[model samples]
Target: MRLRVHTLLFWPHLVAGLLAGLIIGVMSFTGLALAFEHPILERADRETQQVAPPSPGTPRLPVDELIARVRAARPEAQPSAVTEYPDPTRAVTVSTGRTGGVYVNPYTGEVWDWGASGWRAFFHLMEDWHRWLGAQGDNRPVGKAITGASNALFFFLAVTGLYLWWPRKWTWRTLRPSIWFRRGLKGKARDWNWHNVTGFWLLPVLIVLTATGMVISYKGVSDLVFRLAGETPPTAGGPPPGPPIHVPVPPPGSAPLPLEALFVQARKQLPAWENITLRLSGGGAPRGNAPQAGPRPGGNEGKAEARKEGLAPSTFAIRETGGWPLFAATQVFVDPYTAQVLRKDAFADLPAGNRTRRWLRFLHTGEALGLTGQFVAALGCLGGLFLVWTGFCLSWRRFFPAKPGLVSSGDASTSE
Candidate 1:
């Protein structure tokens, strides 16, 4: 039977599906390949001032000693935030510049930065391609429009693909997908059956994943979710102003009350936390109750003193003035003096509009799941790649076939 035009919206959905499928398929596979690599540093990290525990009778390595080591190694660099993960296997991470200057093996002092790993470079480029389609600048309006339209396409594709896969009558012959046989070099029917059946099973996952992903890269549609949930915040775009007068915290090495003590004291007070990551307070300043920035580009970053923390700041994105430590799913802040956690939140804390934002973000990175999640996402990507290829081939044949075909595209006006 020939494809319909107006009723199914098949042709438009087919085209958009191809593009979205290609993007997600290639990107997801590369990400799956990249995950096997470790982010551990190889050189002496300039940002983190991690040191070994003090001698038996000694207190934890003094912040002074760590700071001294960092300054000694890289005098020109400005060490901003200091932090420590309670996990012993990993050294304290620091937030220095645009990139991370991780210092590991506090006792031995080893570090590694992005050398000539073409993989890292490719990974970064892939992210941009996925996010901006290689376009740069503050033209977020344009980016959103493109991604939003693409998302709508993804939604339609998922739905229609599901419908096409559903069989009207199930028989033993049709029950098993066609590809399981040894088609050594046989007909394309088995290939078609394999593709269609696999797609049917994977339909649910890809639909949600693709739709949520689109929601993130586009703001126009996101606003609808925001409006429905009453989650839009007017000041979301601008950074909060810094305090009129900055209150200076003592230098890194000078404080008698170590931040470890402070972190432990604080965690004791807060509940429902898996654990706390003690970061160096770099930028050399205190945390304030002001609005802050850091999700995407082109937001305000008011001037303030660098933040201070347990170790010299070098490893992570430290918020010196306002904002809070980076929460995997949500954001929160802490009061350094009293071990008090301020603005504590998780996924539940997101605005109703933004509530869906968290899942979208996780789906974007595939960190939203465990080992199984990674594998499942990878399978989805593979399925998408197959769907794109077969669909493209089938579509071309259906449209401008090399030879006479069983199917004919309804009309020239069917496609955009």
Candidate 2:
């Protein structure tokens, strides 16, 4: 293929496929493992807290009741947000998303494990290694760079893989033997089928994952995507805070909002909301983002139809405790004026754009339709590991050269 002529013969991609393949393998398996982590954690955890539950058939505690309980339990720690994981049996995770002291609760509220239980620790390590190669320092100086390079290599790999999968030999008979495993080939042949066949089956899902991940991992790649889509870079509004800081003790007269009361009132306002996340009371951390208006027409409902023309203008301001620019589970902001609960991204709420970008991001993570997508993506992850292992075995056998006693697969004896 023209693309194969352009790229596979090149230096970086060939080196990339040969070396970076293992990094891809680790990243894939770790993601897959996390896909199944919730259930695994619950199964391993012991009953640490006693709880009183609603009747058997009664719905799990209303978001209102749950918020009340969590706030009451940990008054010192600010109740930032509540997450109801998709799994029914697993405990609801009330994460600060902080590394040192995040907690997990099963039913009413019970603590899970620290490092030993493998409760997100191992996954986090693999994440660090796969992203940063176990680089020193919390800042992940080396890991960030490696992650960026791997993302570039992955995109290149995907394009080259398409070329490689094509049957360059042409004849069905000749290609059939090559693409399909012969009854029994020893080393290279065995490894080839594992690599080629496994990869071909997982090609679509992995491609989706790789492409979307590339968008997220690389700043330049994402900017290019936005430009291609004709969307402008979002402008930042205020002087950004420098570093993350802990909640500062209030001055003699500084009064913090009563969160419990806020939750009660919020429910009174938006009965439809399933979740709420709050910003922890803190100093030096500007409570929230300044409101960006008119662009996101999402506050207090009731506006005049353009045809009729008679409605009050909607006021726009950042939702109080809204956290920072790109909020990923740390804290999702809720507008103070409209009480319009935030954090409903496009893919989760409804379809957006003609291309599958929205759905594809979901599909990329296998998170499109709740837990089911997560499970499918997990399988893709395992398959990805197998692909990596097989690719390595094939390349190793080819480059290093095995001894004479070690029979090569492409031979008849390999079938055994």
Candidate 3:
């Protein structure tokens, strides 16, 4: 019975690996490349864009001055957000739009036209391949579907591969070869040994990676996770709108609060902030509907009316030291003119389901656990590459076995 069951599982496993091996290999290689993307990009940025202060304790240029300098250098650019690091050596990044930005030397107010590094472009390409097999335009959905299905298959392979790799007779003699690499192996022996050892040791990490990937790729799977956690799934489109809060109105013809004031408020809000990004309201468009001076909210109706009158608030996303889960940021929304914090959304305020979603999202890339997790994930990807190579070798030898007294260069390489 054991032999029969093993045979049944073995055939399906072999066939699935054969069918999905190429796509799996692509994802694994791309994932490996992307594992250290954050650190790699940081190093590249420092090497190219790091600046020095003229003297010790020299205060950096004001945020408003930085934006003005960037706009003066590129008249066509609309500055939308400015990210300030606590480290004075780091340049301020004034973003114009999504993924468009320039690094500004805060000391000299010099706007550096820093284009994406080759490593950044390479990682972007790797991400495209990882997510959608490099599909573009209308075909992205199709590519996404293919990769998602293959990811699900990979999860199955991990599970079954674990079972198949387990020794039926538990002993050093039975298990030693499967658990470790052996010398003097050739052809089928070598391939089989590699396939089993790699699969067994890396199975847990691969399972985690593939399972999180499935959650990201399929809404149904994500919703199921939320359901399992007894939390309602977040609706499509965006997070459900938060309850209305009273936004203080500024008198007509009053200039908006200076960026300095907003930064002060943000610092007061999160004293331990390591970095804070101030995103301008309306993409820094002209504020045409400046609110007339009015009393504070007297009731819920007044608050709703304030929100309806285009008193949109700019936001500060603050990343502080020792933040749990590593990826969560605190969002502070302040009225543009009043500098009154309308709302603050901390990580603790997130619903359990959304928190779970965030964790799964980062865990897919191993960022949730920091650099160590990323390294482990990269190792898993490396093991996956070996598994695919060995599995293909084994399958090739099975279908096209060596004939009597037949030897070729290709055969010699495979046998080696």
Candidate 4:
């Protein structure tokens, strides 16, 4: 009975580990690369980051002027938002869309075209690959299903691995080899020891990483989590309306609120705020709307109301203090014309489930603990890769023992 029970658990664990490892190995490798994505991209954009501060006594350019300048530079590429930095030396970013943006010196309006930089493009591609195996744009059904299911399986493997790594004897003698690397070890013993020890230390982190990944991958699980937390998922009924439409242009000669005024209002709400990025609805002809000049080539005058309803509003993201810098920022919506604050969704205000959900990115990437956290997460990925290799070695040797004399015992041990 004892032998039978052990076999039952062992075989399933081994089989699942092998299958999940193939997918997780790729995910882990990409994760290792993504761990330093922000810093890497910053370095890549060093030229833009090093912009000189405005000349002495030169005032920062007005937000409206900057918008006009950007529009003149790329008429087809509408201005969606501008990200201002606290550092005077750094220029504000003007995003046209997913693939285009420019860095303009707030003081002088000197534009640095980051719209088509190779490094930025490469990282964008890496992000897609990391999230969905480059699933051809974000959240495609095929890519999401593959990643989501595999991620859940990886979580299963981690849990079972912990059970298997537990020492049956429960003695210091038995525990030492499982917790620490052994020196002068050889063949299968070394592989087994490495796999066990690494798994022992990294199991907790692996659980966090894989579990959070599942929350991001599946809506049902996410909704359940929110329900458990006594809150409804943000988009309970339908997908959150496509990114807030840009606010329509205010009347001419009205002189909309200054960007500085809005920044001051945001800072007052959170005194420790460091950075904020504001995205304006584009003024140029909104894409997907009927042709402005006349009816379509088909000569059909589209419904005017539907076209009006399609415009997105302006929104700004604030980097709140005491939260994950990359992922915990608060989202603020504003009336583009009046610059009136419409709503604020800070970290603390989020539902318990949503709050937990927000932490998923930081936990997965190990950014919650800053550089050290990132390093540890990267190490976990490396450890995961090793686990796959050593796992395959151990599994193969056990399942396919060498034929009696076809392979010498000594050679077989060495190969294992």
Model 2 vs. true fold: TM: 0.63
lDDT of 2 by residue, 1-416 (tens): 66557554544545777777877776776677667554454455434222344456645544445545555665555444343433345444343435322334434544433333466577577666656777878768667776666656766776676666666468986556545555556677777766676666777767777787776566565555545656542223111122221233334655434334444444443333333433332321113422221012122122222113221221222222322221111122333333344332221222222123334445556655546767878877887788778777866876786788676536433210
Instruction: State in Å the error of residue 15, model 1.
Output: 3.6
User: Candidate 2, overall lDDT?
Assistant: 0.49
Off by over 4 Å in 4: 1-4, 115-118, 137-140, 236-272, 284-314, 320-326, 342-344, 403-416
Candidate 1, residues 158-214: lDDT per residue as tens digits?
Answer: 787665655445776555553243233222453455567667777877776677766
Listed in order, each prediction's TM-score against the native is 0.65, 0.63, 0.86, 0.80
Scanning candidate 3 in windows of ten residues, the lowest lDDT window is 290-299
For each candidate, what is the lDDT?
0.47, 0.49, 0.76, 0.66
Counted clashes in each candidate structure: 36, 9, 0, 6
Provide the clash count, candidate 2.
Answer: 9
- Candidate 4: tens digits of C-alpha lDDT, residues 250-352: 6666544566666556556666665666655456321222121111111111222223754333345667555554456666655544656655666565455
The root-mean-square deviation over C-alpha atoms between each candidate and the true structure, in angstroms, is 8.3, 9.7, 6.2, 7.6
> With candidate 4 superimposed using the best TM-score fit, by how many Å does residue 163's alpha carbon deviate from the native?
1.0
Best by TM-score: 3
lDDT tens string, model 3, 1-416? 87788888989998999999999999999999999998887777774467875597677777888888888998988776677877777788876765567899989998876554687779989999998999998999999998998889999999988878878889998888788987777767778888888988888899999999999899888887778877766565223234565566677887777787788888888888878776554445322121111100111112344557656565667888897758777777667687777777776775666667778878888888899999999999999899999989988988898786654433353321
| Weakest 10 consecutive residues of candidate 2 by summed lDDT | 293-302
